[model samples]
Target chain A: MAPQPKHLSGDKAAINEFLDQFDVFLLDCDGVLWSGDNLFPGTVETLELLRSKGKQVVFVTNNSTKSRADYQKKLTSMGIPSSVDEIFASAYSSAIYISRILKVPPPRNKVYVLGESGIETELKSEGIEFIGGTDPSYRRDITPEDYKGIADGSLLDDNVGIVLAGLDFHVNYLKLSHAYHYLARGAKFLATNTDSTLPSNHTFFPGAGSISIPLINMTGQQPTALGKPSQAMMDSIEGKFQFDRKRTCMVGDRLDTDIRFGIEGKLGGTLAVLTGVSKKEEWDAEGAPVIPAFYVEKLSDLMG
Target chain B: MAPQPKHLSGDKAAINEFLDQFDVFLLDCDGVLWSGDNLFPGTVETLELLRSKGKQVVFVTNNSTKSRADYQKKLTSMGIPSSVDEIFASAYSSAIYISRILKVPPPRNKVYVLGESGIETELKSEGIEFIGGTDPSYRRDITPEDYKGIADGSLLDDNVGIVLAGLDFHVNYLKLSHAYHYLARGAKFLATNTDSTLPSNHTFFPGAGSISIPLINMTGQQPTALGKPSQAMMDSIEGKFQFDRKRTCMVGDRLDTDIRFGIEGKLGGTLAVLTGVSKKEEWDAEGAPVIPAFYVEKLSDLMG
Candidate 1:
């Protein structure tokens, strides 16, 4: 039962009053802070204002395509100073949680990584053997045939303990087929997120989330998503930030993922920004169950 | 609850005795008469025997991919003689039912077809103007870009009265995009079936039913399905074949489509065949609420 858009006015005073109650802010990166390279208006001043008020702020992104180091660098280049500790990507969460679940000594089990270099690098840092179709030199395009070979046991001489699916654009038939094979053979299937489509430029493109569905259907197995909206990610954030759920707030633009995470995590308040993903008219037409506590045109409107 | 497989002991006399009471046999094709190109063993003989015994046999295939004429040719080539009148494909049902619903004279309104040429041919014969894209040359490869252009109003200029989706292997991004655009713009979206997969060789391929989902998700509009298991198809069969529901039975192999159709249509009975999609072990493991009346390994088992 999300609040009606009419209830969330664009008044600066109302928006600031809503933000004043929360001590910690968890923000989504892609749709809320920035669309791609360009940062959303008033993002920097908003964070500065929050920090000035002694409130904690952390950036959380579900894009498992990149590592925290990369995100940190990118944010710095965009004039938004962020530390490696302040950034949480789904890839990092997946690596940490999956490693803990296996409980195997470092470098013992081989992981079939169907994702970006960030995932591969993370596994390597954790002493796990990472195997994927794409070469490390030019990791952009991995053919479906490579994926098929890995899935059908042509590539693996030993048993794989995990199959990690993250963000990749070149995902095709062979990859999906191979992923299904390994998944059916009892390998743990881990998906980074469940956002079917990601915003790109002016249009929408199929994201890693959409690619995981075919394999999920074929295997008849639900992959454990190690990303935002999952309880694990929320716990990880709360544990690291040392923030009480009742005093923290999640602010994002998407209803299905961002707002859903807020409601499911039982955060103090959920805020919906009108700057991305969903439009006011569409929100009014199809109301969601997870209502935002406040609405704002930009995060900069938040005060101490 | 579907009939127990243990009841079918491969005894011919027992199977025949069970089927004798039914006046009409409505059979589904894909998983019943044949899977892919090969007809299930003894299927033709069983239909012939049933017809010889004055038990009306009608081939009811939900494969909207082909026309009645195509089915007639395919069946005749398989040594099973059947007229177009005795064969009902979903495409024919959709055209007829939709035409009546729209109250348009046959062949008057232009239909944008996103299916096989069989559907286009049927609509054309009935005087409907085929608008979108049609290759009478029987070219099998049509890109999603072609369909996207049609759906986005880039390829065609005429007002499309209906958009029909069937099985197309060349289904791609553009086709789905265009279909969604046209559907969102108030064009009627009529789907061929709701089956998630279609039998292909010994494996399964994504069917038109699965392909329709993304479009449905994007537009948030429910398209009328014109295939088996739908009440409309059942009603059409009953009206055309003059089969009494209290005495007629649906004989097919697939539990979800065939047996469910019988239960939903309120047919007298359902005969689950082990030679097709469902196996005896599955029937035994998880019981169905609308049980089949009998179970047989093959169609000829009923001819004793």
Candidate 2:
């Protein structure tokens, strides 16, 4: 069995010692800072404390539907101090990875976007050309003539070398069919994240990972995911922030994605807040996949 | 090492013995009788020969995009002389299984379809009430207000208790989102078939199974697939046709679906036709998943 996490709220000394250990702090948003549109109490004060203590705070979110700028606006609206650079949305991670890392060759260097405007916006900022997402022509119901054209290779763009998938509100069989043809013809497959479901309006809907499942089935391939729990996202963060791995702490509300992401990324430690999805009973259960280094009833406990 | 399949085309005596052993012949359409829109030279002659020998011919197909009536019309146009009763489409299998076997009861019995009109046609024929499939109101892009409505449980129908998925050409994010909501609200899930890619226009496209994948990911549940290679499909065929399992010979080009379907269903034997997907090289390979009882270079070779 995994070692039990230390209860931080019970000891003020433990909280101070924990705060002093990390120069940089990585935080997950949705379940930690707030639930849906409502912000958690002391969210601003907690971040202010971290900043006053000379700690670097970066908001790392797996939601690919929002670009970094978009996230910054949401954070601002929620009264959280944030900058575009400090926000590492999965959409931005995918864009930077595609541009600075994957680097598909020129002439056939475009990506076929099977996602939302967030991906397109990030890709455009990275100067990575893309097609297909939110395009009116590709959004319509596919006709028999389109089928014939697809079979003959006339309906598809030859320049699409990478198929980047994220959560898409307008996802249709037309987009899926086009993605299938591109993948079948040997294009690389990538996803911003593979989170199964998205939390919205105090409930959950299908996530970006759900979007890739059908393509994965059709192509017999799982796309390289650039989200929480994937080392690629961690590498990008490390590369950009230049943080000391041994002194940087990761904090979140979910055990599977956020805590696991911190542990698998080999950060100094992971802190779990109980105000969200996981509870103490989950880690205490038999054969837990991940256990946090410390736990608190909520994020505001660090204010002590 | 596995034993090699018996080659039926090389010897006339072997073909006769093979044909005499079975009272019924189960055929897969696309690869066996024809490839795309072109019918093989001896397809009609082979069917006529089998009927003259007092054998029952049943067309078993995993394609759910077309109903039995639609299949009969295509067969009639191609001079295949197939009757509606002789066809056991996956769509028809799902309708019968849902209406007769599963029998979801009371006011919450209507199905929400995430497939094409073929499934709608079959379910309608079976007198099962359904919604969502090909519904013009349900085919558009989802909005923020719609998300709120879905989360608050006003947009979704309370009568929907089952979500059936198959190949849908017009499948969109709206349909997937609605299905996810229904499924999350305790609705049973069913699928016509889970074939990964649909073979069409002499090429390949995303199959019915692809449509079910996203929902499976979101729900973390695999639906009961009422199609080829599943026992439920075999049971339905057996219940309707009333044929002895040991006297039925299954014939198709694909080893994974057709041959495995027959073998797993405990049919007398399975014949491999090399015109569609699988070849002798596949079954002859070490640690092969499936091997046919006999091999033919093409379906028409049995006419000898």
Candidate 3:
């Protein structure tokens, strides 16, 4: 049998002991810090307390909808201090993986991107030229005849060696056609994340995973997912931050993505807070794939 | 341990004996008689030959893009005799299945459709009312704000009890959002077919399955697929033309959809042609899931 997830109480000694084990804290954004721009009680104080203790903090979000700069601005706007360097979103991670890891050289590294401006921003920041994302030409509604014309190479762009897909609001048939073309022609396929749903002000919208599933099904090839729960994102983070795995703790609200991220990344430990999606029943369930290292009702409980 | 697919040559005696085994012939369209608008050589003659031998011929296609009337016109335009009655497309089959089998009576039977005009036409022909599909309102480009508004009930349709998705050239976030709303509200989910890619003119385009996958992933609920290889399609066919299974032969170009349809339907036999997607290597591979009963280089070979 494996070790069970330890429950952490509000006792000051216990909380201090828990904090003493880690020198760095990695946090999931949507559920832990805030829920769709609504900050949970004591979130700011908890972060400040960690900072006061001289612990390193990083925001790891699977939100491909926003670039690292965008996330930094949002955090600043929310009265939380953040820097672009401290944010590790899937979009940036994917761009880094494609540029640094894949070694896709310039001029021939034109990617057919199926995502929003966030992905475009990251790729552009990395000096990666791409097409088809957020372009009005590819955003138009397509007909069956348009698809035929696309299939015949009438609108195909040459030298597209990579196809990267993320959460895109302007997803259209033309974009799908281009992605399918590059994928069929042996272009490298990458996705920011496979988060099925994006939680907003109490409900959920289709996430990047939902957007990529169609292309995956069409090409019969799984993409190199660069997000939480995938070891690739860990490699990207490790390459950039050089954090000590023995002193890093991941704090998240979801078991599948966040806790799994910590587990797969070989982090020191994972802390699950109940201010988000998972419940006590789910955490106590048998044969859970992602039980955390510790559980707390809220991250603010540590302030006690 | 099982029987192998017999190779058919142009032996007149053997051809006649083979033809004698089936009184009905079901054909897949895209790769069988035609590839896009250009018909295969001797396709008309082959159909005529089947008809002359007193066989009932039905065109079964997973192409949800066109209505039965549209297919009839296309067939007549191509000089192949066909009627709307002889066509059992997934669009029509799905419409019939929803209206009749599901028995979603009027007033509450309004469907939130995520497809093209073909699905709308079929649903209307079946006396079923629908919204969202080809609605023009849902065809516009949406932003994250639009998705948020849709998630918050600003754009939700009232009493949409069924969400039927098929191949829609105008697929967008708005349509998917509405479908998600209905599904989350306990509406029945239905898909015409889950054919991954639509092959046309030697290239593949995204199919209805590609369109429906996102919604399927978002809801975590599998839609009832009404198309080839599914027994529901067989039930729909039986409800219309009461043909003898022992005397029916399914002819198709693909193994997964066409041959599997015959095998799952328990038809007399299946004939696979080499003019389409499946190759000889795949057919001869060990543990192939859908091995046909016979193989021919071309259906035109039998017309000889």
Candidate 4:
């Protein structure tokens, strides 16, 4: 059954009571914090208020385009104080899952990445040596005749142990061929997230799921996704912060990712904010897979 | 139930009787005709003999990398005289399905091709205008920052009515982004073939399916595949040759594509030759989805 979310009024007493129930808050970035480059009103004040009340705030984002430090910088630039420790981006989570959880070391444990420099940065920071990511060799497009050499496996690295895929703008057959060869030969498959589309400038475009799908189809293997609403990301947060799952609430705009992330992780509660993907009709609609435990006009509704 | 194939010995009378039953022959190129660059022994002779016996032979191949003319030339150079009319490649079938069958014409019917020059060539031959395939603009790999312009739909052609994908050597993010945009905007998604891997020089590499999977995943839509084992190609053949289905026989080395193609099309008969991917054990495996109506050690085994 879908979670029945209590529609909280803009009543200050009720909002304070609701906020009192959770010691920690897991927040989604794109929709709740800001839409594209524009920040929503009361976002910083709400975060500051939560922190002043001793409530821990963890930023959980499925955007694999940026590293944790990059997100921290972006958040700080937006007048919201965010440190790397409080940020849990999918790219960093993927790196942590691969290096720490999977224990994939350098050299033989080399990863073939099909993503941006964010993934590269995280992997490098974790001391996980990888190839095919942001590499100039794979950037050039070739004709059908040129594929003969690639298909011959002459140019592929022999030591790809894991294939980590994310939101790649340069996804080409060269990287795909190498990933296919490795996966077919029993290499581990990993993905930062499987978000079908990403919201940018109030429009949705193909997300990391687009990059990972081809690999999934070719290899006939599903990847171990390291982003919301995957359990791995929640586990990563739990491992690092030691936050009590029962006292932590997830707040976001998307039902499938944020609310589902909280539900799948068995968190304290999930709050759906309006200012993003899901609408009131959708929440009111019957048979939704992931209904939030609470509904508010926006994340900053508590600020009033 | 799997079709029970009658195993034929090298008996001349039985072979001749089996051959006489079918007025038309549909042959798979890769395995039945040749393995990579080397033709199986007696393949050319078998085709010649079939022609001499007044049996019509149609080359049906799932390999979308080469155009019909290319295949015809390859066959001619290899001592097998094949006309372009007798060749039904997946590339040609995709073009036919998009242009003639689907009736997507020029201007607003512009197709975004995600394959090699073969698909481009076939589409061009059919007077179907397309973009992205073999285009120098789409072949360059870019960083995540580069995707911003692509994702914003600045680089995409607005008149894309169909996104046709096949075996692409230059499969890259730029093409995928455009395809994704088009598909998300309700463009028809079509695939030349959904074969996962292509065999080349004793090695297997990522095939057309690898290129299409990302689109499939991103759009949550399965493409209408125009290749072997699909009724679309058979329909195309029927439209062209008016061959009697009951009097037609499919000869292939693989049970999945060749035999299944015949089964799906309900052709006169399906013959499995053991000169390619499937072994005798596989053909004889219990509960196989696609068992040929007849089996031979090789096409040459019936040539005595």
Candidate 5:
């Protein structure tokens, strides 16, 4: 059985000690600060508490539907001040991986996107050439003749060396078919994240990872997932911020991604909040996959 | 390692002996008889040989894009005369499963389809009500306001009891999102077939199974597959035709679906043809999952 986390709902001394233990605090959005658009009371004050204590805060998110600037705008609109640099969204991670890491060269340097504007925005900010996302030309349904064309490679752009997948609101079979053909022709497959469901409006919906399920199912190959719990994204975060692992703490509502991200990265601590996908019983269960260092009823409980 | 099958090429006596072994010939259409629109040289003759010998021929296909009548028409066009009743398509199996077995009571009797018109036609023929497949209203992209509607159950049809998925050319996030919400609302998930790839135009494309991949990823539930390799489909075929399992022979070009279906159904024998997705080297590998009883260079080789 995994060890129990210290429930610090009313323990002022333990909470204070916890606050003093970390110089850097990595927080997950969505569930921790808000449930969809309804921001929890004292959520901003909770972040302020971390910041007022001289802690470096990075808003780590797996949502690939929005770029770093878009996320910053969302945060600002929600009354939580944030900057693009402090945001490490999966789309941004994928963008950096494509630009600075993969370095796909000329003629075949363009990317075929199977996602929404956020991924496109991130790639644009990185000055990367891309196609297919929100493009009207690729929005139409695939025809029977298209299959023959796809098979014959006549309906494809030869310059697309990589296929970037993310959460796409307008995702359809047309984009999927083109992406499948490109991958079959030796294009690299990359995904912003593989988080199957997106939590929004106090409910779960299909996430960015679900968009790539068909390709993964068809190709029998998994794409490079640059999201939370992936060490690649963690390495990117560490490189960008240069934070000491021993003095950094992770806080989030989900265990599989946020908590796992912290634990696997060998961070100082992981704090689980109850307003999200996971609960205390999950970590308390026998032979639990992950156990956080501390538990709070909600982020507002940190004020106590 | 599995024992290799008898190479039944250039052996007239062996071919005749094999031909006389079964009363019913279960043939896979796409790979064994034809590749896409281009029919093999002796496909009609091959079927004629089985028929002349008083053997029952059933066209068992995993394609859900066309109805049994449509398949019969395609066969007629190819000069291989076929009856609608002699076809056991995945869409037909799913319809029968819904109309006969599940028998979902009214108010929740209507099914939401995430497939092509074939599934719609089969469901219509079976006197089952279904919505969403090729519906102009369901073809639009989901907007931001749609999320709240999806969560609160305002955007969903309350009468939807099942979500039948198959090969859909117009598959989009709109249909998938609605299907996810319906599945979350306790709708039974059903798939025509889970064949990962479709053999078409002498190449492979995303199969009906790929249409359900996103839903499977989101729901974390495997839909009841009413297609090839599922014993339910085998039972449906047996109940419809009354063919003795011991006197039934399965012939196909794929190992995973056709051969596995025959082997698992305890059919008399399985013959592997070289004109399809699987190769002879597959069953020849160490500890091969399935090995056919015999192999022929092509379906025409049965004349040897």
Candidate 6:
């Protein structure tokens, strides 16, 4: 466990003092900006205040189910105008990492994707061939039986180089079994995010983290998590923005994912909010990993 | 770790001599009888030999996906002929235990099943009302939106006494979230088994054990696992058959499930067999639990 940082309480004066120190703001989506469809009170005012002070804000979400285009649309409809480039999604981060690290030479190798169209589109855009056993056209038509051929090694004969696990609606036993087989055969296993659960309408639902964790436990193999709270996400930010690590802050709700990510990535500091998936009582009850540098009632509280 | 038995070895002749002392057989399915489709060679001969010597045998499988009838059919197809009454499935065991322990008035109490038809059928047969949520019937038509109504305590208005988790085909985030809610609200959390993996067509698939373990970890709650390898299963056998625990031998292929069950239940001895889920190399590897009383190449090796 890392040392806890001094926390500025949710009081107006303390929050304003903490916000004045950061130049760049990296915010988490579901738990920080909004929970599903409902935005935290005063989110718009907070963003306006942050921008007024010349702080570059990026909406980073681990949910690979939605593309950047989808997030941009959602944010716009929610009274927050965000550009596509400003929205950094796990799918985009994973694609960039795969393209750079495991670059198969031109006439790129086929990838067996167990993910949504966001991942499919990203892989295609990167000059990678997608060899899908399930119906590529119909999103929910992929069943466990479809991937049985892959598990038995028949699908890999066509130069399949990587097994990418993002968010697939049709994830089943066979797909997981096949992914394990391909991974055992030295194929790279790239997961979009390690968020165990995703926010739904009322409660959290199992995400890519739940599925990927089991495979990792069974095969004794760990896939590179390319989503927020991973260091890879921070690396992407640092590489692209040329921002000073000690000057950037990760502001989010969930302690396990957001705050831990900030601490592990060696980011400047973390600001935890109480308006999302996690509550103050729950957060305090279970001793949080690293104490946030600041705590606020909502994002707007950051500017007093 | 328990003390290693004196006659334990991966030898054929020594195993045969040791098997002559037992008159009652308690067999675990996944690792003992067969793994996936391939039947362990000499299993049928071993069973026939036991029956010839007036030994009573009972097949106990912790997999709650199927009923005793399903196991009967599966075992019969694989050359192991046994009636439904002769086999004990976890679904049946769970239902029996729940009915006996809870002692809810007939047709009054409701059970939320996070399992398959086997559990539902058994609960219904016991005159317990089945509160439907995420099963095969509802999962096909319902989206994440439909789950909000059930999870937030709207649908559970009546007397929901227990939350039974067995083998669910649609064990999604929504169902698990709802189950957690019910459990937190003083409802009983009863699981079918704790075996992490089950034998599939050609390999091991994630079982109820994997699903239940995570929930247990998350909730900091230990559920009553009414399945084989549990002390409850062994007690059920002793109560029903009036069998002497000191003279009975539990035969299985896996050390964690089968051999451990026998030792923990204080049964006489255990027979470990090869040609199933557990390999000799795995057993020989470091840090495994107590060795079986006898280890054979196959079940039939005990007859000679």
Best by DockQ: 2
- Candidate 1 at residue A143, lDDT? 51
RMSD of each: 6.2, 1.4, 1.8, 2.5, 1.6, 3.9
Error of 6 at A162 (Å): 3.5
**Candidate ranking (DockQ, best to worst):** 2, 5, 3, 4, 6, 1
Model 6 backbone overlap count? 0
User: What lDDT tens digits, residue by residue, belong to model 5 across residues B1-304?
Assistant: 5678999989999999998889999999988888878899998888888889899999998888889999899999987898898998998988988987888999898999988889999999989998899899888877877887888989888999999999887887778888999998899999999877777766777788778988998998899999888887887788789999989999999898899999999999999999988998898899899899999999999977
Off-target runs (Cα >4 Å) in candidate 2 are none
Candidate 3 falls in which docking quality class? medium
- Residue B246 of model 6, lDDT score: 77
Judging by lDDT against the true structure, name the best candidate.
2
Higher-lDDT candidate among 4 and 6? 4
Q: Give each prediction's DockQ, rounded to 2 decimals.
A: 0.09, 0.78, 0.68, 0.54, 0.76, 0.27
The residue pairs in collision within model 5 are none
| Native-to-model Cα distance after best TM-score fit, residue B61 in candidate 6, in Å | 1.6
- TM-scores of chain A in all candidate models: 0.85, 0.98, 0.96, 0.94, 0.95, 0.86
Over B135-185, each residue of candidate 3 has an lDDT whose tens digit, in order, gives: 777878666777666777776766688999899888887677778878998
- Put the candidates in TM-score order, highest first: 2, 5, 3, 4, 6, 1
User: Across residues A132-227, which tens digit of lDDT does each residue of candidate 5 receive?
Assistant: 988998888778888878889888889999999998887777778788889888999999999888877777788888888889998987899899
Candidate 3 differs from the real structure by a C-alpha RMSD in angstroms, to one decimal, of 1.8
Q: Which lDDT value does model 6 have at B156? A: 50
Docking class of 5: medium
Off by over 4 Å in 5: none
Best by TM-score: 2
Q: At residue B186, give the lDDT of candidate 5.
A: 92
B1-304 in candidate 4: lDDT tens per residue? Answer: 4656788857788788889899999988888888888978888787888899999999998889889998888888877888899999999998888766899655679988888788888999988888888878766655555466666767667788899889988776667767888898888988999998878756777788888877887777999999988898888888889999999999998888888899889998989988899877875688877778888888877676
Clashes (backbone N, CA, C under 3 Å), per candidate, total 12, 0, 0, 1, 0, 0
